[model samples]
Structures are given as structure tokens and as C-alpha cells.
Target: MNKSILRVAPMVLSTALCTTAFAYTVQGTVTSKADGKAIADASVSLLQKGKSAKTDQDGKFTIHEDEQDTTSTGIHNQQAVGFVNLSQGVLHYSQSSGPVQVKVFDLMGNLVSSKTLYGTGSVDLRQGINAKGTYFAKVHVGSATQNIKFTTDGNASAYSTSKTKSALLKAGDTDKLQVIADGYDTLNVTLNNLDTTLALSLEKSIPPEPTYKFGYALKNTPTPSKGCGTNTTLKTDKKVENGEHHVVNVNGTNREYFITLPTNYDNTKQYKLLIALHCYGSSAEDFVHHTPDYDHPTPYYGQQVLDKNGDYIFASLQAVGGLWNKGQEDHDFFGKALTTIEDNYCIDTSRVFITGFSYGAMFSYSLAQDYQDRVRAAATYAVADYNIWLPQEKGMDKNLPIAWMNVHGVNDDRCTFDKAKNSALPRMLKKNGKASDGDSQFTDASSEILQENQGSTGHLCYDFKNVDERFPIKFCTWPGGHQWTAHDTGNMSVGWNWESTWVPEEVHKFFEQF
Candidate 1:
């Protein structure tokens, strides 16, 4: 978890300069703000009286001021320079704000280097020996600042340890560094042993509002309407009959989620299962609204609850951060949800599926990659491409033998379909061991429509269908951008008639074919 250190008692600034009698050394580490992970290549420095010392790869620094041994040198009694440490993360650029700033000052209150960095980039300082005094350093990004103060006695060699392993960390682990520079607040950082990755970025303040808010009590939400009969009512008890909405503890946090029973559900019947993920700021009900046929039709059914005809049960879960696990400790929350569903329902062990929309779709993609043994297939909507957050597959060796399908809109403003062609298709083809000779480039036609002319361009079937040797990953693009087109809506509906010009029906047929 990323945490912001709200406040700390400022380090007492001392004019007390380092003399030849005092040992002068300073050490620390740098890390990512997203997840408190450490970063490498960050530069640490100690500055005094117009002099500075650069930190080694380990983010450690040593500053010495005097080479001549003299009893009179001890009488200088003035701290001259300040200390500055800087590091950023891989995803540091994701922030709306630009680069982070680093500032250094001498013990006599003279300013030195003031540099700004875009990423967890590191830089060395210039302070050296024969400079006896204290120094001040500050790190600033936007309105946030962290400060630090240090003193150096010119005696021992000032060794830099940028790449050296810190005694504070085990051989393979990183350490956290606390920094407060000239003009900013304190920045608590985690530096990794390898210094190649960053976990997260966080401010010292409380986290912002969650992306999703459940309004089960409100209409137009995903909850079953009152007219859907006793089983569909929000107040329906779990123990009385077959119903959704189970309350369970996720890592000790109480949460309620909806479960879909198979149409053939019987007390004695066991079935396969599927986990459905929701997008950011969305709920389990959102999927149902998108797939209205999952609900029994009114009027003719007359308040009778509809049973799912599919052989698998569906579970819609709520996440702590308005999303499925995002490579954080809260990932345990997703694991907890899985156990809750398996414990409460008669789920088949060998046939679990995962799917979602937007954020949910990304989660589904992540689960398929990470939990390959647990999931047999994955289907995602509105996810056209992959990135550092949701990386695309690499090769057949990396494929998990799980079926994959993605629904994307060409005009999607959030995730363009064309952007996904390189990463997504390569991974998919490598999994299936199938490749196409034609150009794999896909052009973004519009927000709602994308056309791949290199291969087959048609309404229903794509050009490279089922070409991979492992489980085939399929891509479906709509002409519109970021919208559920008539085709997508058809696929979301039930009993979609492929011959009736209903696009949703074709989508159902597509899923049923597997």
C-alpha cells in the first residue's frame, strides 16, 4: 500500500560544522511512490560551503571537508553544506504533474544545484572533501517537498554507493529512505535491491474517493427490480432459497456480492463457474444492465425469476479500489472472493471462466495471465490494447492454454483497438502457435469503428480466427468508439438470433461455439 507521511518533526537545523575529529558519512535509499517499492539510480548528495558529494548507485553518499589534520580546523565550527537525495519510479510519468525537483544548500545558506527529474531518474552531486560543514537538501514535486540536513568532516574518503548493497537491506531486498529537502515536506521512499521496478506512487494524504459507489437502494442500478419476484427482491434471504447477494469477509472486510446460478441448478447439481469484473466506478449490476437477457423477461414471465441456462455459475464481486486487484496487498481481496464463491456454491473445479468490462476487463486479463491454472478462459469488453499495467502476452511459452476473447470499439477514446494490435495479437498468436503472413497492422477508423484490412474484414468472422496453437485469443471490433454498438448489445442479450440480424445473438453464438 502507498502511504503518505503526513507530518514529521522537522530535523533540527544545526550550524554545528563537522570538524576533522568527527566522522562524516550519510546513507539512504530511493523508491517508488505508487507501491513503496525501491528504485535504483537515484543520486544522493551532501553539500556544504559550495561543495557537494555524489551518491553511489545504492543511493548512499559520503562528504568530507578537510585533508589537513589540524587542531585549528576544529575551530571553524560552521556547517557549510546540505544533503539532497533524488529518485523516481517507472510509472512516475503517469502522474498529471511533471517532473520532481531536487535542491541543495551549503551550511552557510548558499544554494547549490536545483534540478528537476521526470522519472525515478537519479543524478550525482558535486560536493567533495576539504569542505567542512553541514548542508541542506530539499526534494519538490508540484506542491510536495521533503527536506534533509547532513554534515561532513574532511578526513576519510567519501565513498559513493549508488550500486552497492545497503547493509540495511538483505541481498535481494531494498530499503526505504526518508527525505526532506530545502523547500518541501518529507518524502518517504522505498528503494529496491535491483532498483528496476516501482510498485506505486502516493501522496502523504488520505486516498481519494473510490471510483465506484454502490447504490443498491437506488433504481437504475444493477440490483434486481422489485417486479422480478421474491427471488429477485433486494431483501431476499440467502438461506431461504436460491438467490444472489452473499455477504462474506474479504481479508476481514465485510462485503456483499451477487451470484448467478446455472439454469439447470439443482441442490444436487454441480456446475462450472465464472467471475465477472466491473469497470472503474462500476458495480456488479452494471454487467447485468449490459446483458439484460440474463434477467428473465417481464410480462410473459410475470415476476418469475429466470434461471441461467448456461452450464456455469456467475459471480460478480466488488473490489476495494473500485477495481479487481491491481498488483497490491489488496489482491488478497480477490482471492478471498474466489474462496467465498467456491465455498458457498457447487462449482466445478476444472471449468472456471473470467470476464469483465473496462477495469473489469483489465482484471480479467490479469487473472487469466496470473491465475492460468484456475481459469479456463477469459473474455473482456472495451479493452483494446495492453500496457505496462496490463501487459500483453509474450510467446507461446507464456500462454496458459486458456481461451481468450476481447471486445473493443474502434472509436473507443479510452482504449483504442489499433493500439492493441501489436501486443495483444502477438501474445494471442504465440499462445496458439498460429501466425498470419499478412501485415498485422490495424488502422483506427473511428472511435466506434476500427478496420484491419491486412486480413479478413467482415461483419461477424475476423480474418485470423483460431490461428494460434495454444488457446486462441480472438479480437472483436465495432465500428464505433467506446460504445456498445448494436452488435455488442446483441451479444449482451440472450437468445440472440444470428439469422435475425441481431448482433447480440451472434455474439452469444460466438461464445457458445467454444
Candidate 2:
């Protein structure tokens, strides 16, 4: 979370000089208006004395002799420089002597907030750093020569081992804080209640950045809406049920699916098509309720609620084989299911999307690759990026340029977050692009980070833009189990946490881009 500090206290100036025919110099002391404390070594110049005097440790100084009626002097102090631990939300930029500008951007490329400081002081960031992801702040003075970046993230709840949020802290409670500086490795600090005077040595960069590799090759930027298939091409029965099952026969095998129209379906408008695939051991009916959140239904279902202005038609389809990514029958499921929706609904040929969990999630990746022309984008949860099990026959489509998003939990033994982030995405990202790629360049992947943790759940979000032009793939994680993490709204942060399991809502929001 980003915070603003608002406070301004003027500096006190006073001078005393002997006034006599032979008197020439003056003396003065400079004090800070903020704490009424004397500021040592402040520069003071007396015009009458035609000389300058520096304030001593006691904020006292004497000037040389010059003919004058009174000692008249002007004082100037050096710009204050220091770091403020933002966890407390008290801001120092507001109290800066020179002009300053602050801007914050979230990992997903969303600009959280920006402020320009002339002389205001301090801001409260109680909601800013509370389990949010790594935020990048650009702090600059009137000149661009000394601009700097601040990386801030932490879970206040984690400050205390106690599970109870209230037990985390209270006014007057004292605790030792540990910080690592540039040259020095570590330092232990003790702070009091509202201890605003704390300062520490800073490095060229407070948060060191990760090194990035460049070079990429992408086919073209894929739009969210308008893929390969259209209503005019997939000729099938137009009439369909909103909830009950609908079957389409392929080679004598009856394929079953459930179609749910948007809440306000209009023939004149084409809606985005969503193919919801169930995880292992789950059926089409089960999938209708599995998406967004496993415990409750989402706006994806017209019978449930209307989301995004009722602009999407959902087709919940079942895998022909017991397992997806198994064979040809299982392999061709998306093409058939998507074509069925194209035949029946007024859908934008380009905005066709797929989302699934577990094995279904893996299948969504395969589907996007095999049918790149039809499926523009996809989102999968409880699955890792490089965890593909494509049969030998379907492996040839390995290098497809597609826009994708994934959500997995670190606690998921089945699909580990570390392996996916550290192994899968990196490898797949390189494979998905050639060394010479888009205008964004391979080295400049977005790499936005949003880190949040509530209790035992740690939510992390990362984005890699221009994996292919306009085809930014984003990855998000939370401290969760193998199954869907239950909605932990009470513990989540309003700054960026999800209402019903952050993954589900974010997935829906991701597809909305198309």
C-alpha cells in the first residue's frame, strides 16, 4: 500500500548583533520548527558583517565586525535526507524542504496513486502496505538528477506470531525491527510509539532489483475478442437451454455441455464466450459452480448473476475421457465445445476464452495452443505453468503465442508455486518468443509484483508483458492448499485483496481485458 505524509513546520531564525559605530558583524542561531530543537551547522550570513558564520552544535554562532545599526542576517540549511520506515503510515515527503513528487504503480500495471508535494507533510498508509505486492515508488525533487525508488511490502499480521489480528500490536507496545543496509548487512532497531525520528543509512537502491534477460519473438499481438471461429462458421442448432444439458454427437459419441446465456442477452450484440472445463473427477454441472470460487457460483453463470454488464456467454463442457490431455477425444474437446458455442450464441469470434482447475487447467493451456485461432486467452488455477502433460501427438504446438494468466498456491504440493515461477514461466516465456521480438523487447518484461499475505495465506502477483506483443501473461499466487483457497475476505486487504478467493475474481477481471 502507498501512503502520503502531510506535515510542514517552518524553521526558526533569530540573530543578535551589537549596534555601535564600530560594530560590523552579527551572530545568529537556527532551530527546527518541527521539534523546537536547534539545527547545528546551519549556514548564516550577516550582510552588515560581509561574512558568514556556521551554527555550532548548540545552534550558536558569532559573526565578524562590520559597521551596522543592527545585526541583519539570512540563514539557509542543507536539504534533509533520510529514510522513514513506512509500516507506521507516517510520511516524510510531506515535510520535505524542497518540492517532491510521488507516484506508485501496482504489479499488474495499475497506477495506484500519485501525489505532488510542494510543502505538505506526511500521509497514513495503513491500507497501503498491508499484504500488497511489491510497489515501486518514484520520489523526485524539482531536478531529475537525484530521483529514487522505494520498494515496500509486508504483512502486518505477520509482525506477530500470534494468529489473532488484534494481538499483532497496540499503542505503546515496543518491538525490535531489523533492517539491512547497502554496505552493512544488518542492524537491530528499537522504536517507540509513533517514533518518527528513526533514520538509517540508505543504499543506491533500497530494494535491489532482479536482473532480466532480453530478446523475444512473437507472432502477433492477440486481441481479447475475435479469435478464429465465428457464429457464421460453426453451423449448429441455434436454440439452447440456459441451465439443462445440451448434447452434440461426434462420430456416434454423444458430447454433453451446458450453455448459460448472459443475464441480458441480445441478438444484436455478440458476447464473449467462456469454456469452463472441470478438473479431474468433476463434471460439467460441477464446473458451473467450480469457477471463480469452488464454494459458490459466480456471475459467469447467467442463472446465477450478471457480471461485466452481462456480456459473456458461458459453456460448461465435460471431458470426453475420464482425464483431459489423455488422447485425441480428450484433445479435441475444446475445438468441439467452442465450435458448439460459436454455432449457437452471438459471440465475438475473437474473445473466446477458457478457464479450468487442476488437470483442467493444464488442458486449458493445451487447448489455447492447439486451437490458437479459436481461443484468444485462458486462465487456470491450482496449476503451474510448465506442468503440461501434452501427449506426444499434441506436443507439436509447443510454440504458440497466446495471452494467459495463472493462479497457484505455494502450499499446493500438486502444483508448486516456486517451481512454476522459478522454472515453468521462465522457460515457457523464452520458448514462446524469439530473441528478436516486439517493441517492448524481451528484456523489458513487465515484472510487476504485488505481494500480500493474510494470516497463513501469502498472495503474490507478477506480470510479464510483451511475451508476445499485447500478449502479456500474468502469474498470481497465494498461500493455499491443493483445492481452491476459501474466500478469506475478512483477512484480505481492500487495497488489492479479493472478495471470494483472490484468484477467481482476478481471473474474471483478466478475461475482461478482451
Using TM-score as the measure, the top candidate is 2
Q: TM-score per candidate, in order?
A: 0.40, 0.47
Candidate 2 matches the true fold with a TM-score of 0.47
Writing each residue's lDDT as its tens digit, candidate 1 over 1-514 gives 1111111111211111122112223344444454554544343333222233443444344433332222232222233122223222111211123555656666434676676666434454333434655554444434334433344454333422222111110112123444433222345554322112222222344433322121011011122112222222224236312346666665567765667665655534445566666667766644433333322121111111222355556677766667554453334555666766665555554455666667776676666655655565677766644532443343323333455777665556776666655555555445443324222222221122223423222244353444432244556665445533324333334644322232334334433443
For each candidate in turn, give its C-alpha RMSD to the true structure in angstroms: 24.6, 25.0
Cα displacement (Å) at residue 285, model 1: 3.1
**On a 0 to 100 scale, what is the lDDT of residue 304 in model 1?**
15
Write down the TM-score for model 1.
Answer: 0.40
Off by over 4 Å in 2: 1-242, 289-296, 299-308, 384-395, 431-455, 485-499
Question: Whole-model lDDT, candidate 1?
Answer: 0.43
lDDT on C-alpha atoms for all candidate structures = 0.43, 0.51
- Model 2: per-residue Cα lDDT over 1-514, one tens digit each: 3322112122212111122222212444445544556656555543332345666787666655433211122112233332222334334643345766565545433566776666656544323555445443444433221111233446544322111111011112233434332333344444321112222332233344322232122322322333223333433344443454677776567777787766756655767778777777877776455445343355332223536477677777777664664455665655676666666557777677788877777777667656655676778776654545553344565454566777776567886767666655654465444235333243423243334343564566666544554456777766665655334432334543233555565676676665
